[model samples]
Target: MEIKTIGVVGAGKMGNGIALSAAMAGYQVVLQNRTAANLVKAKNSMENQLQKLVQKNVVTAEESAATMARVQMTSTFEKFDAVDFVIEVVAESLDLKTAMFIQLDTMCKKEAILVSSTSTFSITALAAVTQRPPQVAGMHFFIPPTKLVELTRGYYTSDETVNQAKAVAKQMDRVCVEVKKDSPGFIANRIYTPLFLEAFKAYEEGLASKEDIDLAMKSSYLPIGPFELADIIGLDVLKSSLEYYQSELGPSWSPPLSLKQLIRAGRLGKKVGKGWYDY
Candidate 1:
């Protein structure tokens, strides 16, 4: 679709990180949030991430500032009307995302591609809300956007959007992988959920400590164990998604009781300073 500028909806961690990544890839970025405070935080977060890139010599200081400059944060969704693509990065709620897509469908140009970052919802339901099924698709990015190297394609996503999203992913230096369906959690989650659930089960059954399980994963060549990654992704977010998956997939994927209790106590991983490990 020849995307030049992208509209990122939501200023939470994923939205802000996606905007920063797109800006670093040399695209003009427009990011929006419903609240002014979140918008400000998103901007600051982008700046801080750019600074880290400069520190690591991945991006020059001038380049980092200019990349940071390319990103504009707004509280107005109306500004995204002209963007070539609208990636809905809002929280993981089907109703909220569908409503935003319906609004974007009315506000954006007909040709503007709509992509959802939803991890569990079916794209078919979201596409039904927009009346642009061919133009609507999934463009899931792994957490910690800087190192994103995998993406999932929805069942109805057009080959054109897949090609376009792959182009964008390449620009971000990601290793793009296609999924045949928008199945709950797509391929990565489909494969990893069992392992994660097993780990949680073991912990709940008092089979082993969290640290030992994590060490096993690291020793076995996995970058980090599920619990460790869940901590980074926020335990609350993971817990919520687990509940969603359990409802959608049944008992085998259900979140263990320990994880639920941990989230209720507010220990949501590295961002909150306590989870499976000390931050």
Candidate 2:
């Protein structure tokens, strides 16, 4: 299907970046959040991103404004008319995602696709909850969609839908990795989980300080090590992924307990200005 208009389910960093990229790609983006407050936050964040694009000369100031103008912010499903594809990026709970898909199946056009930005969870199960399973698929973007290297596919995704997503991704300058299944931790998460867990395990076993481990990885020419990267991504997200991984896999997926206590105390990562490394 040729996508003309795209819809995003959440307006957080991931959703907003996806929406901004869609707008910059010259597609109409319907940015849907549950509340006016969320819509406002998205708008402000989007404007800030656009301004940065302008400052960095990535886009002309006029183009920045025009790209942002292509976005339509709304707070209800009623605004989703004519949507070609919906990328659901809300909370990662399976029940909530299934419920949202049930609602979306009724609301969107018959041909429109329903995609989840879930790192973990069964897309087939999610599709089963919806009326149109063929139209339901996983369109997993990485943390930032604009910098997307590739996205994984769900087991049940149709060839046509996958192609459509691939074409859209290419148009937006992204690579696509079609994963075989949509189980918890599709592909990247599946591979990343063990690496991150081992990092936590290293800490738990008293191998070395978080700083030294990170330094070793960086000095060894790896992108970023576990603890430092976890600090970059909030501990809460890791907590959620760990729970999902543990539930699906086994004890090996267990995150370090200290990480949980930190999250419990509300000291998330970079967002909180504290983690294994202060940032």
Candidate 3:
């Protein structure tokens, strides 16, 4: 099916980025969040991001305004009934995402494709909750949304669904890598999670300070240090991903002690102004 209108759930970092990209790509976008305040914040955030793009000459002011105009922000899922595609970017909780998928399946048009921006969760498991399992897939976008988007297929996801999802990612100007199997973490996270585990373990074992480790890695080949990246991604998110990995991968994937301690103290990440590093 041709995708003309897109629905994005969870107006947080990932959600807003996805909505903005779709709007810029000339698709009518419906960005939904449960909280009105979050919807406001997301709208303002998109405006600011578009302004930055304008300043950098990545997009013209007229284009940016037009992109912003294409997006419709809402607090209700009812608005998604007519959307041709729905991307769920909610928290990485299995229960939360599964529930949302069930709701989307009930409310969205039967032909609408449902996708998730999940990093580590199983797309097949989520598809199981919906009647249109063949239409459910994973479209995992990175933090910034400029990098690669991993397209994953659930056991029942059809070839047409994968092609349609790839089309959406390409329209958003993102490179796509297809994961043929229904696996936890797919491609990027499957490899990156182990690196995160080692980094956390090193810090916990006093092998090196996070700063030193970050500097060492950045000075070498990485654009950003693992710890810094973790903080930016949210320690809570990191811990949750780790827990999921441990359950699916092995005990070695368990979150480090220091990581858990920081989360217990409520230092999530940059959004909260504190994490492994202060903001």
Candidate 4:
């Protein structure tokens, strides 16, 4: 199917970025969030990001305006009935995402493709909740949206569905890496989780301060340190991913006590102005 309209559920960081990218790619976009406040915040955030792009000469003012014009923000899932493609970018909780998949399955057109941006969950499990499992897949985009997108297939996902998703990713100018297995964390997080564990262990063991560890890793190869990246990705999100990994992978994937303490204190990273480092 030829996709022209894209629907994104949730208006947080990843959701807004994905919507903006689609709009910039010249697709009509529907960005949905449950709350009015979040919708407004997402609009403002997108506008600011576009302005930055304009200043950097990455996009002209006219181009930025056109991109914004292509996006329609809504608070109801009913608006998604006509969208040709829908991406769920809600919190990384199985129950929450499964409920969303069920709703999308009911609301979206039969030909519409449904995908999740979850970093560490089973695409097959989510597909099982919907009747249209063959149309379901995982399209994991990283925090801040690099050029890479991990496209994963569930047990029931069809080759046609994967091909369509890859086409959409290509339209958005992203490079696609197909993941054959329906494994937890897919590829990126499988590698990243171990790095994160070592970082946490080093800090917990008092080998170095978080700042120092971050500084040491910030080289020409890696633009951001693990702690800084964690802050931007949100500590709560990190903890949740770790918990999910621990359950599916092993005990080694468990979150450290210091991470839990920070979360318990309500420091959820840059979004909240506090995390491993205060903003």
Candidate 5:
């Protein structure tokens, strides 16, 4: 099916970023969140990012304005009926995401494609909860979706659905990597999550300071070190994802005790002004 207009659920970081990318690609975008305040924040954040693109000469002023005009924010999911595609970009919780998929499966047109932006879970489990398993797949976007994305076809996902998702990603100027087989963490995270866990382990064991380990990695091949990225990802989120991985992959992916304590202390991450380090 042709995807012209797109609906994005959740107005958090990933949701807003996806909306911005889709709008810049000339798609009519409807960004949805459960709260009005988040919808406002998402709208303002997109405008700020668009203004930056204008200032950087990436997009003309007129182009930026037009892109902004193409995006609309709402708290209701029913407004997405006209959209040709819908992408769920909520938190990393499996139950919550599954509920969203089930709801979207019922709400969206039978022909309208549905996908998830989950970075931790397999699309198979999510698709199993929906009636349109053939049209459901995982479209995992990197932090900034303009760069890279992963398209994972669920066990029952059709080739047509994968091709349509790839086409949509291309239109958004994103390079799509197909995960031929469904893996626990997909491609990128399967490699990186373990390393981040090890980093936490080292710090927890007092092998090195968090700063020292971060410095060591940054001094080598990585852009942002694990702890910093953990803060950016939110420690609670990191802890929860690790717990999920540990359940599936064994102790190697075990959530660090110190990390759990930090989360228990209510220091989430950069969004809350503190985590591994003060933000």
Candidate 6:
């Protein structure tokens, strides 16, 4: 299927990044948020990012302006009617995502491909709640949406759905990693979550400071340390994912006490100006 127009639900960091990515790739993007304030924030964030791209010479000023022109921001699903593709990038709550999926199913055309950017949720479960299972799949983009896009097929997702998602990813100039299994966390998080948990455990046990632990990992093979990554991801988000992992896997996957305490204290990470480390 030809995906010329893309709709991104939610306009926070991830949502805006996805909108920017699609627009940069020449797709007309309708970025939807929950409120007018969010729409304004998303627009400002996209503009700032475009300015950075222009400054870095990744794109000329004319190209940046054209890309910005392609993205339309909204606070409702009105634009989704003509959208050929819809991606829900809402928070990782299952109930919230399911609700959004159901809304997308109702608002979009039957042939419109529906995708979720959830990192640790089941695409199968989300698809089951929709009327168009064959058109539903997982297109998990990394936090920045500039790294890799994971194209995944749920239990009921069709080959056509998978292929169309791949095409969409290629159009965005992203490297595609096909996730065969419909399991929670897909591929990256299966490896990532363990490393994150171990980092928390190590810190909680006083084996190392968060700074030193992150330093060690970065010194070895990673671009950033686990605690630092967790902070960027939001401590609340990491704790929530860890809690989900514990429920799905076992008690051993329970979130560390240190994480819970930080969350309880409202230190949600860089967005909030505090988390594993102060920003």
Angstrom error of the Cα, residue 59, model 5: value is: 1.5
Please give, for residues 1-279, the per-residue lDDT of candidate 4 as tens digits.
899999999999889999999999999999999899999999999999999999999999999999999999999987798999999999988899999999999999999999999999999999999989999999999986699999999999999999999999999999999999999999999988788889999999999999888888886356788899988988888898898889998999999998899999999999999999988
RMSD of 1: 2.1
TM-score of each: 0.91, 0.92, 0.96, 0.95, 0.97, 0.96
Worst 10 residues of 5 by lDDT: 141-150
Distance (Å) between predicted and true CA of 270, model 3?
Answer: 1.8
Off by over 4 Å in 1: 146-151, 277-279
What global local distance difference test value does model 5 have? 0.89
lDDT of 2 by residue, 9-113 (tens): 998878887888788889999999888898898899889988887899888999988888889999898877689999998877777888888888888998998
Model 2 misplaced stretches (Cα beyond 4 Å): 144-146
Instruction: Name the candidate, 3 or 6, with the larger lDDT value.
Output: 3
Best by the lDDT measure: 4
Give, for candidate 3, the lowest lDDT window spanning 10 residues: 139-148
lDDT of 6 by residue, 237-276 (tens): 8878878888888998888898899999999989899888
Writing each residue's lDDT as its tens digit, candidate 1 over 1-279 gives: 589999999888888888888888889999988899998898888888878878999889999889978887788877777799888898887778889889998989888888888877777778878767878877787775545444455556678877887788899776777777767887776778788889998988899999899989989978888788888787777777777788888877777788878877877789879987778
For each candidate in the order shown, give its overall lDDT on alpha carbons. Answer: 0.81, 0.81, 0.91, 0.93, 0.89, 0.89
Model 3: residues >4 Å from true position, as ranges?
none
TM-score, predicted candidate 5 vs. hidden true structure? 0.97
Rank candidates by lDDT, best first. Answer: 4, 3, 6, 5, 1, 2
Superposed model 4: Cα runs more than 4 Å off: none
TM-score of candidate 3 versus the correct structure, residues matched by position? 0.96
Candidate ranking (TM-score, best to worst): 5, 6, 3, 4, 2, 1
Superposed by TM-score, candidate 1 places the C-alpha of residue 74 at a distance from the truth, in angstroms, of: 0.5
lDDT of 3 by residue, 1-279 (tens): 789999999999889988988999999999999999999999999999999999999999999989998999999988888999999999988889999999999999999999999998999999999999999999999984456999999999999999999999988889999999878789888888888888888888999999999999899988888988998888998888889988988898888899989999998988799998895
Candidate 5's error at 207, in angstroms? 1.7
